[model samples]
Target: MLGEPAAMTENTGDTPRTLRLRADDNVAIVVNAFGLPAGTVFADGLTLLEFVPQGHKVALVDIPQGGTVVRYGEVVGIALRPLPRGSWVEESSVETPVAPDLDALEKATRVPAPLPPLDGYTFEGYRNPDGSVGTKNILAISISVQCVAGTLDVAIRRIKQELLPRYPNVDDVVGLTHAYGCGVAINAPEAVIPIRTLQSLARNPNFGGEVMVVGLGCEKLVSERLLPAGDVAADTGVVRLQDERHAGFGMMLDSIMTMAEARLEVLNRRTRETCPAADLVVGLQCGGSDAFSGVTANPALGHAADLLVRCGATVLFSEVTEVRDAIHLLTPRAASPEIADALIREMAWYDDYLAKGGADRRANPSPGNKKGGLNNIVEKALGSVAKSGTSAITGVLAPGERVRDKGLIFAATPASDFVCGTLQLASGITLQVFSTGRGTPYGLAHAPVIKVATRTELAERWSDLIDLDAGRIATGHATIEEMGEELFRLILDVASGHKQPWSDRWGLFNDLTLFNPAPIT
Candidate 1:
């Protein structure tokens, strides 16, 4: 169904064009980059009554007041007033519909049959002792409190400059610093989230199991607590800046660099081996979305997700607010009744969290989303859910929880790009695929993020930033299946270190943002 426009001009010359996803849909999105002006007519005889921006929808049929505005074969909104055919469907003229009731939904009734098993696919990766594989072999230094962040930053620069060059096999050294640990309610029941997130993050496969911790002696979260118990290597070391052994900043720096070199020695000996595709754990997310998101980028990403699932890989899709309005479509796809309940439970918890903050799902779509033609959260949710593909939801993870199962998972996290990426990293995703419409330069320091652009124009403009151009689907140049296949291959190439995403090539890594829901003292 992708790349098949319902109404299009015959010639390749500049003319008005629109794309309708389904036969019953009464609205079609304008495809021209600069938009079509008033009185411009389409091949199917639908004329524009007013200017409709690119990616914005136009009514395909006359509708009375309070009539439903259909897109993607679903009711996205209600007409604010009588809308004549050829009228541009502005965001203000549409009202969001009520979300589906959670308690009344069916459970696991329409689980999709598994796709054919894909075998003989493999990537070169580093195999850790704990049975997890890593796409990169890097020594990660963890911090227990924010107080040591500056000290760790200084030490990391020295390590990267003086020590890293000595180890050719080791990829890079990263200091895992965050805003948790001190000056907060560490004993609060909700405090476990950040604590466990920090603990799990230190064990990320990319770190090559060489975990080292740095701490200020008096922080509530001690250095030992941040290290993974029973999994830490005998040589796992911790450096305390407040220790009596450190007389000054110079001694503190020397201590950290000394510990870092030991970890690098271990990590440098690790080498990439051929591993099955099943070893991959990937995260799927989107931001700066537009109406074309569902039509192109998301669908293509969905197709790739399906392929990953078929290959026995673990794939995670998140963003609770983005999934809330589309929960109705996902419940029945749960692999079991238990999985369905887990999905609903996460949704309910997030609902309460938002309500406590005096916010609602309507607050999700940003101004960029609206300018990109996402009128409301309802419309955005419908487009956002397309990245899940048709795979059955096999597992669920609460925020900050490490993954225990290996399949299509719902890792509940906020919609913020940095926060979601952080949580996904904590959940053990070694690679991430982020799709955007309006464009973003988000990348992860611990993993490779493959950025996919929803429109060709943005991709062409930011050629160095975007890794894949799913926008070709909207331009009738590529099918979703083709793009999906290409993306899957690219994922393997990147994971194997055969190729590097633009973000990695440019070292455009974002800071680690911890989601601390508990009260901060």
Candidate 2:
């Protein structure tokens, strides 16, 4: 028999190396640097029956075949065979539970209690012509086809070296490049996904609605389709590389440079003005996840998400497959029956999408995810959902659609970290909070990503890289509430440009990947 749950102590170089989440859980995760060998006794008198790797599960009590294996107060899996006490619970020993049927899910059954309004929080942001607010003032150059990327890159480098210094208010020049725009079925019904993605990304709030387009002039995706209402101004809004008026390649580059300078002149006049927190649009995501993800970092970030919702800000949580196993857990939190239906639509669409590829949710929980102790998609989904906090889902966005309301929204996207981040950026997130238990150096060019660590070990190992250490909560040094409050303040400060996250400081950024479900010909 196991003893009662006791308060965990701080790391004093000789502390216990296990973590039990709940009193009823049948297993605990190994927290030691190297796992303990067989016969190692925990304080509760439970002895290890075998050598378990770090972050792997240790069975707490004897489990009969087909018995439930509980963790985080829910059944994560079922034992495939008799699991004796102290046995290592690897993926092979447990079987994933069947995903809940969409038709059986309840609607608005677990609505979150409205939190008291958070007042007076404000940030200095660039206000856009479309009424959206931007955390950074950047001049984005949109390209219609992949062919113009090389040319655009050269122009961007020159802009950064020469014109950028001239317009001090402009942050940096970004080429909105992608693999789409030609050599595909552009008019196919499914092609709308990537088409809208490029269109909306061009109008990202951080660009301040000052649009510019570069086209190869022969691509299927024309400049008119890429820009909004074909609204590019005559002076400097467009440059066509194939136009005959250009004498040579040098003229083409010079034409791009001239158009860029005109946009810079317009963007340089903009300044940051005080805006209420309600104007904020935040993207929430996770990568390189581990078991501690739910226990510390994600929960704390969820709390901050709830706080942001209370203050009337828009918070978007995405990654379709990451949430597929936990669809039942979210539908009840939907703000209305219509919202619940929208959630189901996104999930069902993804399921069909996967079936066409002859794949399923098992494709998730990457190797790093398994090394971080997530045995299957069921286990990963439970931890990933913690980032959403306890908020009613007020809206849902199809891939690449722009966000129009303020509240907790669900933006449906693939589980790939890069693709998810790109869709979120296109949906208009000004800043992002990314939690990790296994480490990643992931960053976005269009937004500031605040990397959060789930364990003290990773935080200490990569101190300069991590922005916040919610790992303190796991060590008993900080409560979830305290860590959440700190994160909320950090969001405001970072959005105000008063603080720069490591991703921003070191200029580490990943390219924008469009989610093109359409086929290539």
Candidate 3:
């Protein structure tokens, strides 16, 4: 139903077109690029009493003050005052509704039936000694503290300029630098989040298990702690700037480069081999969203996510606040009671976390979102959940945790694009499908990001940046299934090195920002 065109009425060339999502809905969104002016009439004979912007909602029926305003067949908000038919329904005119009660949610009552297996889908990937596969063969240098970031950057520049050519197979070298590791309460119970994030990032399948760490000698988070469990030791791939052997900045650069070249040599020997689709880990996220996000791009992504699950690939849908208001819809689709409880636990944890910060879930639908027709977080949440594709949620991962289970997993994270992308990297997503309605240039250094546009205007405007255009679904030019199949083939092609996404081609990667909730002291 999501990918299908909304209920459309016949319209002459001069008449405006609008989309009503459900028969029971009282509002419909304007589909024209530029909104229809007041007094314009639809083919249904519904005249606009006031001007409505594109993607903005208009009341299809009269309602009294405090009446429910519905969209997607759900109560998104309440009318603040009397609204006449065909009147523009803007954000200020709607009052946010209370969130669903998490405690009363049904668990595993409506789990989706297993989709028929989609087999024989495979990709060319680097096979690591740890038995994991990699989409890109890169040597990542981890850091124990922020102090060594500058030094590491210098060394990485030299490695790229002087050493990368010798090892043609190694994709790139990255410095896994972050603001954590020092000047914080490292021993705090909450500190495990960032610590584990760094650890998990080093273990990301794309890194090829050739972990290298750079540390300043006296940091609170020592270099050894950043290493994998059984591999921690002084002699194991660590370069300490304060070591007696490093007498000056030049020596420090040499030490890192020496260690880097060794790892690069090992990585250069790796080659892409055939791997099952099950080895693929994909992350689903949406940003710069508008109302069209729910109706177009997100639903198409959801279809692709469902396809990936049927193919035995691991898929992750994240952003706790984005999913908070729609938790009721998700809980019942959990694979089991334990997983359902895990979903609730992560929600409750984030709720408490937000409360402690004197914030609530309503602190969303940014100014850009308002202009793009998102009235509030509740409406945004309903649309945001579409990326999960009705798959039974099989597991949950807290912020910064590594993903362990297969199938669909909810990787909890803050909604900020950089933060969510970083945590998803930590969760082991080899490829990410990012949907944008208002549009963004967001990308990640560690993984390939496929940008999908929700509107045809955006796709045409940013043709070089957007990898796929779901906007055609809104115009009735493409169906959700067709877009899903297109996206799925694109994913395999990109994963197998047969294609490169715009993000990777242009190197438009954003910095990784860790979600550190512990004290600064």
Candidate 4:
């Protein structure tokens, strides 16, 4: 009766956790932590007519035929008829009707729609040679091939310790080592040639003027060897990976120091200016989401995203599957018929991917989200979409497309945070505003990731990880507006070369550029 408290506990199986929705209702809502069959009966005085999977709802009390199902202390939907005492609630689920699926009638409720003005707001950001800004002046070491990447990484580690006693502004000297960059035909030139080695490491706005890159001179990708005379070659050091095994490594270290010394002298020239919000491209993301996400953190960020859009900044929000269940909310937001069609195409792709994996997002989710009370993808997407903050859908993006227009952008990704982060960075995102309801250490490589926490306990416990506390909305200490503004300032600091909540203290700067998509085939 202790572990098997189906008679007492809200869900059956593991730990002693139970929940009651109504005071007047009888019989307990039994959550089966384990998958017991339709006819399985527990020793704790409870029997199961059908199994209730984890993160799905169950009956807290017996319901008469046609009775209402209450959740969040409100009538979510009507029970699809009668249920026996102490039986798991199945088939019946919460479904709110909508007129349009992507850009539709979501404002039927009394809550006001987002209508922030587009005036007097801007982020003073730089547009580089490749149309990106260098938020921080970084000195980096990149290897065009993985074979000699170890030598470069080993040398960089030693150099960090060697220079730590001198260069305080030298944020981090890291190695951008990856599996690709070679083994492909370099002679075959196309419209968008393979510049994987140069772009992610060199063009990444975080790195300043001078840098070092070592290459194997003979790999199939020998573009690092082909150079426009006197420009990139004048400052770059490209040594053959096969160099006498020892002279190459020594020359690389010497080149790094030479570049570092030159970059240090110009650190004084960095300045912050008031650039228009049009220059800013904010990326919207949510991880470790919970039941309270739509009610709190996600919507708060959505408002902030709307503010940026109103000020002329383009906001890019990813994770298509997370929003698949909330298709009804996006119906009215789509600006035209084509955008709605594109949105539907991406959703169908996500469903196909899920089917290939043999799992539905509703039936399976990350364990952390389940622990935080999320039911399914529908509920998750409904709450997740709230982060867009009600801005009009000016544009939508494919997996790695750069967001060219301002407004709310529904971008697609593979749902891996690290991979998604890389794709967004490569797609030209200047910064990423990530909100986590439960808790997460996820961040993007090469771009600034501002983490907002949704719970007060998580905020206090892991203050170092959380930059903004949306949890105050949950506890009544701060309004969403206050938190939204706070997050905005944090974004400005990050764009102005200020340290992130953790990076300022720990001196950690990430330069991860992962491209998971097939190479433009």
Candidate 5:
């Protein structure tokens, strides 16, 4: 079921940025910043976009500082003061931020640009019979409903997990459990987030095949929809637990053994190879983002993101709320008018969403971020926007959607890490660069997350869980350039079948907590 893996290249030197980040504009980014700058003209090793120095000007010309700064064609923040031409654009700062300052800042983020190139890129993944790509190798046993989840988990757990040594290529073996498979209305679905989670898991590419139904049978979510039920290539077949055929848990395990064993040869048949950078679809995600997250991890990763984009890898950054302060930086890259229009629509949607007695994303910055020293959401958004680098804003998306385009893109969702990460994974990412402040163990079924931390303290505290740490930059022992290059190589290691830190190696791809959009019927 696994196809050839995606390709990788030698270190992508810093991407060149053409749009000069003038000292005067609050917004600073260029559509094309690909070459190195001469000494003194721009700071060396600063990487303003991706490895561009902090003083690099995406806009050579400038306007009054108090005037709005536009990048992707939106207002990320307002100028704290007036500015002169050729001055570096500073991100908009709020006046007594919690007061009236938010109105102007939120308007500056989530704009559009042309879609970056999408050709000549691919990751080596298992393409299910349905044509989806998976990043890892996993054996999946789907339970039809909550009724039989326990029985199936027991059957899965009883298997010799240690025996995986015989199958070095496999990522993990897991039983897909749900809080509901039965007991809920079959059609009670009304844009339920968890329902989308089930479909996401069933649709994930990391899994080799599924053998399941309710351990009892008659569950609404039978093998018919969950597994590739009748597909031979998927090496899949669905059986009901209540079926007179596969009667007991013992019998189910035996059946699973035979079913799982048959896929070993196919799973082992795959191996890693060099692919272009663009072939790698690493989800650029942040969670448990605190004030420092935007300031530290977010922008640091953005530097790497711009480098990857320049090298031609597909980078997907999500959570529209997190980018609220800098949506304007993304708009200029809009792939189409529809994408641009969708961007505007969601902007208003979020605006009205907040005005209705509910706070908008600004209030959504987590408590950890506040305690870790983030002040308010606007400041957090300003920092979070840096993760996208300086690539064009190719497309704007809502949750539970597909991304077939390239360049710098956004997938919209509330501020939950797993929710946005899962949506990006479902779209097509075998790897993810996850930055976190406080600790949380969240991993997708197939996507082997490359975890990063915002600060050095959290990095040392959770070193075992983290794959890379940019926090050292905060400590001054390391620079963003050093960290960015380190992260780029680490990405290659994960893609090459090296076991990731957060995974149990049982291939726990939980899509049960996802949110997907429904096609209009």
Candidate 6:
């Protein structure tokens, strides 16, 4: 079932809508665009005692002072004062609850029954020599310093215009550029984060192991430092701009183009072969969230995520602050005690990081999130973590680290859309599923972003932008499982190059934003 109806029927005066997630929950999110007026009635016979803005919470039952307000079958906040039934529960009406202590968390207490194997699913993918598979046949050029980005972009455009057509097999050329290589304290302990991010990103599966690097020779980060040792192919692909052999910018372009062609030759010879679903590395995320996000889109995506796990694929769930509020609920679902410990470690590290900056998890739930009816981070997080589904978290990766294990892995990253997407790419995600209620034109150059809308109205309005619609689940037009299956099939098609997501079709790509926690000077 798709839960209770979200909108008022014709009999009710207006379409004053509300969405209740769980039976025990006392709050329901408003569904209509304009705030419903007092006396508005919902399908469930719940009358609005006061105006409730769209996407904000409405009290379904009386909440006494300090009483818990539940959502998602969990306590999201404590009522600061008495709240009568039908009252709007704004952020000021409730206080965020204390975070669950890390040491006392339950471990492996709610392991879900193994889902039936989704067998026989395959995608045509470029197989790499290292046993990894690539969804795109692109020749990617890595840059060792920010100073080289301008030169590299010019070179890439020239290559794409003059050289790419000759290599019919290669999809496109992309420069792996970022703001990290120079003018920073290179040896700072925190500097390792960006270094590793750049290093790992150079090896993303989409690159097909044909990695080339453009460098300003004297930069703190050398091309050799970004590529692994004994990787003769990658080492040979490095083109140093400041090398004596490059007399000027024109000569530098010559060297880069020469190196790029060599990699293109290797990438061109590669062909797509049928690969099992296990070869997929998918990243799950949510932004511009609203009440319907968890009720429809996120849960639907979670179901799809579970299906991917059943197919033995790797799925990554990230955004540190987004999940911090639900840490207590997640640690127990860890695959093992060690994995549970890892989850806590990442959470604790992020907590300390926030404290040092004189902030806390509450700083999340951006202005757009609030406008979409999420009163605070607690409520937003309760919905955000749903993208992970019910699968046991098999592993945890720190910010910018590479993924090593399969199943649902938590890759720690900031909630910023660009930063999260970039770090996920570094962690080897070949495809990304981003659920949005308020909507954004977020895209990445490194991977195809499959945008999903949480509401029907938004979907109909942004038809050309959104790839999938989980809103049907809320409107009773589709079940979460049906949407999930549809998404699963779409993932395979996109990964196989049989379909191009809207982001890719329009060539919409956001810049690669590196997460640099250390000092820049």
So what's the TM-score on candidate 1?
0.97
Better of 1 and 6 by TM-score: 1
lDDT of 6: 0.86
| Model 5, span 1-521: residue lDDT tens | 00010111112234332322223333333222222333313332223322322312233334454555443232434557654433434332322133222223233243434335434433455555554445677766666567766766665565546345677876566666655655555554434444544545555556644333334557654556555435533225555566676766678667666665666556656554445666566788877765346544666687677667766766788776765554544454455556656666666655665576466456675667654434455555666666776665666755655566666677666567766765675555667888887766777665687778876667777766766776655444566667776777677667656545564453444454444232222
TM-score of each: 0.97, 0.96, 0.98, 0.70, 0.68, 0.96
Write candidate 6's Cα lDDT for 349-388 as tens digits. 8888889889868878788887787777888888888898
The C-alpha stretches of model 5 lying farther than 4 A from their native spots are 1-134, 162-166, 183-197, 208-216, 227-236, 345-362, 475-478, 502-512, 516-521
Better of 4 and 5 by TM-score: 4
Evaluate residue 48 in candidate 6 and report its C-alpha lDDT on the 0 to 100 scale.
Answer: 88
Write out the backbone clash pairs for model 6. 55-373
Off by over 4 Å in 1: 1-11, 231-235
lDDT of candidate 3 at residue 352, scale 0 to 100: 94
Tens digit of lDDT per residue, candidate 2, span 1-521? 01212334245565656777777888888777666789887777878889988778888889999999988767889999999999999988999988889999999988888989999999999998878999998989999999999999988898899889999999988989999899999998889889888888988889988788899889898887766785755344678888888888889889998888888888998899999999999999999998778778888888899899999999999999989888888999999999999999999999999999999788688888888789989888888888888889999999999999789999999988999999999999999999999889999878899999998889989888899998887777787778888999999999999999999999999999999988898
Candidate 3 Cα deviation (angstroms), residue 406 = 1.2
Q: Give per-residue lDDT, candidate 1, residue 83.
A: 87
lDDT of 4 by residue, 1-521 (tens): 00111123422324333333335334333333333455555545455667644323555557777676554333434556776654655434333322124434343233235575778765556544445555555565566666777777766676677764466655565565666556544444321222532454354556554445667666654535433234455235455556454365677566655555555445434444566766777777888886556555776787678678777777888777677766655645677656766777777766766787687656534767766656445556656777777666767776656556667788776555665666566455778888887777776545677888776667778888888777666444566677777777677777766556563454444445454333322
Residue-by-residue lDDT tens digits, candidate 1, 23-112: 888998988898889999887888999999999999999977899998877789999998899999989999998988889988999999
| Root-mean-square deviation of candidate 4 | 8.7
The 10-residue segment with the lowest total lDDT in model 2: 1-10
Model 2 score (lDDT): 0.87
lDDT of 5: 0.55
